[model samples]
Target: MGWSWPANPALWPLARELVKATETRQAAKSPLPHERETVAEIRHKTEASNGDNVDRTSAYLTFFRKHPEVHWALLAHLVSRNAGWSMTDLRGELLPRLLPANVQQDYFSFLERGNWLIFHDAYPQLLLYEESVKRQTTLFHLLPELHVSVFMQAVWNHFWKTGDSKLLTVGLIMNEQHYLETHMMSDETYQTTVVKTLPFALQEVLRLNLILFPYRAEGQEDGALRLAGAPVFHFASLAERIELGKRLYSLLFTSLRLREGAIQWASDKPHTGSRKDFWPHLFHDLRETAPGKAHQKKLGGCQLLPGANRLYSPALRHVWKQVRHEAPKAADWYPATKGVMRQLLLSREQPASFCAEEAYCQALEKIERAVLAKGKLFGS
Candidate 1:
């Protein structure tokens, strides 16, 4: 991949200066009293909001409202909401029938760990940025104390100087995915137990890799909601994940209906880790049918089939206990400047407008058929 300077010619020099400053700061031994206090306060806030899916989701939205220039906050909020939905799905109606108990537990652990680790690494950075904006000075030097990647230190400094939101967003997308590359994706336990399993392969075949953004389209009635997002292919590849994040960011911000409608929906609806948050007619937080009963297909191209029963998509608190996470194994996965610069080029490409209704409906019907087939074969 060819790496190039940011579009603004001035940024090349600014990047060099920030990189040098970060290197110099990393050699320091201790912080001043006020700096120590600032670190403590930010750490406290990060922990307070890091409690669970609900807390983290709200924290991201709150931060985005306060500091809209940091585009990654809203992106994180929406993506984290999806993570919560995935967590609940392990214990929801269809997955329980398809996957055994032990497999479900492992899958939950896998999803939860990735969710926890990303927040752990990213939240402190957001707090530091907040503090920087208040004090009118860059505070990213303290990032080393919080164990954030050096890549972010430079990116934050550049953003503070230039106010380039797009570059900053892509920078975050690159940093966090690489952060997971070592801690979660490359780990022996998750690799053997989750990623390499037959069930994992089934995720691709069933179209579960789609990251959906629900919104009410223009000229549509208030009661109607629709889905728009690109399917994530080759998720195991770091390059692919970065591309997926950029494509999603583009889709969300570039389209008028998606941007306004999604913000309105998220603002009005509190996330409870249920599909019902967006499509209440198709999904319910409570079980409406007995377990092992054949589920009637409720979906017809993203709208419910007429008079169909709602699917049981349980809330996070109802299905799974709050998880206590072990500290992430320490490693800085930042590549050289040449490699990081290559990711910036992806932000320049405009992704075509995506509508996920067809893909999502197909996946739902496939799961419904699987659940019915398993019920008949085992007579459960």
Candidate 2:
């Protein structure tokens, strides 16, 4: 049977209170009463901040200055869709109110041009919060036995969501020797390159439970189910998320510059035997560190960047190469591209450029034609 998640509008208030109380109790555990008091005060302030007649901009500015972490929690509320804040509201009002003028303008310009908000720095806190909520409510609770609470928090989504509300489920595939692996087993270059970087990604996921899923064993005794997907983590309150976001935002900025500089530096150097192999690996490393979908959205202010042809073509080629014998012509690949591209366009600050628009449109057209061709061949 297919899966579906029906809206539970009635649960909003109950869920909100549960989240608040849980957060407060967790905060009170701190040795310092001041920390606890600050948490409590923030909660009260949050209640007061939601006034219909009051100026929300001023309220947010003041609240943000004092309790920046609240932004993470509030964002979680927005992301979870337990509250009414849409992407439109976030783009139009909340973002400018929180971010600096220059940052806001840069992002706004990007949004004005059609682009996908998939990069890491462009994420809005609200969207990150929503993904976190979904991860927790769906995956986390599913595995109650595993204690992954420490890594679960509001800011983790800064590392997750694809800026298009397309949830990313990361799997850190490992082998018996504790080395990382990918599907490209025969290719030595792909395997070696993936191995080197896989550990870092694995460590990050393990440390925070930010990105997690399960993989089943090939051969299991009596179908014991060797691997079961679990809930990664859960944050105590929205405040923690905001605090986490501040820390992560700074780190993300540094990481981006370092990556750009490395790419430039590698390009300048003379390549020898090992360096030839290493250079491409360096690009792979850069891709790993590249900002996630959420960051791209908020950073570009909602720009619709072009989809990676290199990425799409390879997938299409792989499917055609591997499965063409069974399904001579299949349309499965096109929908993924169409859906992602459409989402990217919708998230863009403006329509894409002529070239980019034409390319994606053509890509879409090709996929549609492929689907039709398959339908004619199969008569299904």
Candidate 3:
């Protein structure tokens, strides 16, 4: 069944109570020493897992396994895997040919910062939820002490009462994207150096903004993997990003084939921050050819073209060092209740098919052609 914002008038009073309670807690005196200790422990855990992409990815998966009702953890794990793939792609064979070293580094910083910031904000909330389950009570009022957004305090409270995983997932998707809009998307440095740059513009034009969820169907000979996901569009718009995330959630959970298959694949395969995680036939963590060597086509509509060398998609540890990020700037982007309701309503759209393997392959070909053209023109 398609999920929607609960229309029961009785629930409205509950939501109002949650908001008032959150505000009261926020206005309360400093946390006692015991509360301080708990906050510190969660912070330490969040930092430990947030050290790098692999650590963060595994943390999300582990949390999801333990608390499957928190659908956002699983979704975050899959998307975090994609973020790692993108980080490696910057240092991969094709992109180096297309982008200068400094430009590549800058792009990595941009992606890494977003990944880090989101984990910083979201992991504590997950841990708090775990604590709540353990204590058999809702402890989301402590969210403010952890620097979590007030938006989530209400949603978590609502989920505690209703066990509505879909609503909580949607709430999280909205919260994180809105969080990014404040911290990363609007920053002048990122705007001037990353988002507004030609390379960033080219990413959209080349259809490189894809988020793939891969799964191997049952009884497929040779364990052929299939990908299902929609490309992100109009990323500069917060609404578009929210919509894209909702679509991904729908695609991941609504289809039984995809949900079961993706879960199995994630279980069987540990992420190594390489495209090889999903399509080892095309991508390798090690270099397959000498630098500047002419290469044959490697893909044809998601299948390998005959005799093509596996493209170099290095693991994250090989290509990049772990980043030590400054604490994210504090701010809340929560909208009025009316705006929240509107977003929730909009999140209830029909599930759209994200089987775009052919399109993804086409994008890869475009990048390959561009690289070849550059080599020919510059004689590098």
Highest lDDT scorer: 3
lDDT of 1 by residue, 1-380 (tens): 12345565645854575566556665866878999999998878887887788789988988988997888898898898888988888888778888999999999898888888888899999999988888888888888888887767878888887888888898899889988887899999999999889988888766777788888777787658888888878778889999899998988888877888887778878889998897777788999877767665666666667877788899998888888877876667764435566566555567887888788778877887787787789864
Distance (Å) between predicted and true CA of 196, model 1? 0.4
Model 2 ranges off by over 4 Å: 1-32, 61-380
User: Which candidate gets the maximum TM-score versus the true structure?
Assistant: 3
Cα-based TM-score, every candidate: 0.93, 0.17, 0.93
> What Cα-based lDDT does every candidate model obtain?
0.81, 0.24, 0.84
For residues 1-380, could you state the per-residue lDDT of candidate 2 as single tens digits?
01112144432332343354335435644234643443344334533433211122223233333433333322221111211111121222123233345543333232211111111111222222333355453222211111112112211222232221211111000010011111122235433443234432442344322211111223433212211111122222222332333332222223434223322332332221111111131112112223222222111111223542111111111111111111112111111121211111111132211112223233323333443454457542
Better of 1 and 3 by TM-score: 3
Per-prediction backbone clash count = 0, 40, 0
Off by over 4 Å in 3: 1-14, 294-297, 335-338, 346-348
Query: What TM-score would candidate 2 get against the native?
Result: 0.17
